[model samples]
Target: MQYLVLASRCLIGVVFLASVSTKVAGPAAFAAFVRSVRRMLLVPSGLVKPVAGVVVAAEAAIVVLLAVPTRATAVAGFAVATGLLLAFAGAITVTVRRGTRTTCRCFGASTVPLGPAHVLRNLLLVAVAVAGGVAAPTGGSLRLGESLVAAVAGLVLGGLVTVMDDIRALFHPTPASRRH
Candidate 1:
């Protein structure tokens, strides 16, 4: 149970850490993400920057909250993660239903457009957070060996999310364009 809980915490933490790195690489990259958000209609044009700020701040918080060794902190992190994933899933679902194709900017920069896949992906993450939160102990107690194992497992899973777009693209390539 501890392993499961700790692994979940690490997975979400690493995910946020990787995501934050890409986002804060520089203002240009962050601005691109903001633009993508506007294009997706996740927010009105005027509110794009503010929304982006909140998203980035939340990601930063997730990284910290999930890392601290405490049951309360872990639960808070999972709660935050769950909300973020649901919000993302909702945004993608709306875009897909509207027959709109827009880049996902999910990781600072990307060409993957909004699709059912994106919605499913977010749902999966939400499940992980929920399951972890449930299994988490009231007191975050782990031996050195257990902590190491959980961290390793979490990092591996987290890294997989980082390049998931590319992996999906490999299996389902975007159709090529041709000149008329």
Candidate 2:
């Protein structure tokens, strides 16, 4: 159970760190993310940049909180992660239902349009956050070998999640194929 909780925390932290890093990589990257935010949500153009900033700040906070070696902070981190995932899922659902096909700038620039896959991914992350929160131990220690295994698993999972859109593209038909 402790290993599971640790892995979950690491996974969430890695995901958020990747997300924030991609968005803030450069001015153009950040701008693209803000544009995506504007397209996905119903916010006015003037508010889009600020909204993007808030999102990045929240993600950074999650990484920091999860890094703290305490059960309470871990729970808080999971709670924030879950809330953010739910919010993202809700926004993606609404955008998809509206027939919007803007590319999701979620991990930096990507051609994958906001769709059910994005929402599904977020919901799965939400489940992980919930499970981590519930299973967080008050205090514990792991053998060096066990810790390494859990850490590696978490990192691998997080990397997979960050590249989900690219993986989906391998199976999803191209625009030209759709016309056939």
Candidate 3:
């Protein structure tokens, strides 16, 4: 049980780290990400740069917050993760419901548009965050077998979350649009 919670924490941490790494790859790439967010969010054109910076920084912070093995930090990470996922889902929902399709620069530049899969993915992440927050373990100790299981679980879950957009793109034909 403790190992399960730990694995969840690691899975979410990996997701955040991946997001930050992709967004922070280079200045032009980050600027493109900013533009995508502005388009998808329907925000004022002037706010794109700041919004992009905040999103990237928040993802980086989530990675650091969840990396700390302390109980308090774990709780904070989970809380922040929940909020981020909720915001993501809300944003995607807005685009989908309003009949606007926009590319998601989530985890770097992507041609895939927002769809139900994105919302589902966000909700799934929200569930993981909630679970981790409710059952976060304070100790770093784990038995050999438990450690192995936790490592495998975290890797598999992280991998799945990382490619969610790809999976959605393959199946969702009517996603907002691959281009602006």
Best by lDDT: 2
Q: Each prediction's Cα lDDT score?
A: 0.82, 0.86, 0.80
Task: Name the lDDT value of residue 14 in candidate 2.
Answer: 92
lDDT, candidate 2, 1-180, per-residue tens: 788888998889899999999988999889889888888766888898998999999999999999998899999999999999999999889999999878877777677778888999999999999999998855677788998899889888998999887776678767521211
Candidate 1 clash pair list: none
Question: Quick one: best TM-score, which candidate?
Answer: 2
Residue pair clashes in candidate 3: 101-176
Q: Could you tell me how far off, in angstroms, the CA of residue 76 lies in candidate 2 after the best superposition?
A: 1.3
What ranking of all candidate models by TM-score puts the best one first? 2, 1, 3
Off by over 4 Å in 3: 137-141, 168-180
* Clashes per candidate, residues 3 or more apart or on different chains: 0, 0, 1
- TM-score for each model: 0.90, 0.92, 0.88
In model 3, where is the ten-residue run with the lowest total lDDT? 171-180
Error of model 1, residue 94, in angstroms: 0.4
Write model 3 residue lDDT over 60-109, tens digit each, in one string.
88888888878888888989999998998998999889888777777766
